[model samples]
Target: MIDVHMDPQVLAGLQEVMEGEYPRLLDTFLHDSEERVKALRTARGDTQALRQIAHSFKGSSGNLGAVRLALLCQRLEMASAGDIGGLVDQIDREFAVVRAMYEGELRRVFVG
Candidate 1:
């Protein structure tokens, strides 16, 4: 099983600074992540496209403290000479786990 954890310190800092915009920030990250995952799934055998997508996804996920997701993206980005399909599948599965965690966090913060 993959472990999913968001950085509490990063989240607390965002909440401190973002204030009312915190929910929106969460929503945006979730939405953008969905799009990036789709792009990764549809990248086929295009290494350039896959690398570009993974690099961008890595930076944003790291910014939001999704450390595991960012690390997965980093692996995908560096796998220009290996099995791209396998990495994409791994990313898809892992993103599902990460997405669930983020959604739960959003509810805890916004709905509770």
Candidate 2:
């Protein structure tokens, strides 16, 4: 089965490379993602701002192997107006799923 929410291989590589800092990376990613989503809400109606935010968010999401979220962000970046609000909502929804997965992983890592 292909998991569109994330790429486990990229995450595994991150774990191998980050060692003790992996957890911290996850924490930071969640926090930053929240902020980005907030920015998206405020940047509505400003197409350029939306594109820039989506571009930056896409890079971070891609770096973290958030495959689906990154693709949504890419779509936002390329969006020339039209249903910006709906796209932002979609991105937010995808982030929620990704956030849940990361939070679950964190709990297991810390609790087990």
User: What Cα-based lDDT does every candidate model obtain?
Assistant: 0.85, 0.90
Winner by lDDT: 2
Residue 17 miss distance in model 2 (angstroms): 0.3
Clash number by candidate, in order: 0, 0
Per-candidate TM-score against the hidden true structure: 0.90, 0.93
True-structure RMSD, every candidate = 1.9, 2.0
Q: Tens digits of per-residue lDDT for model 2 on 14-109?
A: 988998888899899999999999999999989999999999999999999899999999999998688788889999999999999888767765
As for candidate 1, its clashing pairs are: none
| Residue 66 error, candidate 1, Å | 0.6
Error of 1 at 19 (Å): 0.8
The lowest-lDDT stretch of 10 consecutive residues in candidate 2 is 103-112
lDDT of 1 at 64: 90
Model 1 agreement with the true structure over 1-112: per-residue lDDT tens digits: 3365578788889888998888899889999999999999888678999999999999999989888888888988998557788888888877787788888878988876
In candidate 2, residue 59 scores what lDDT?
Answer: 97
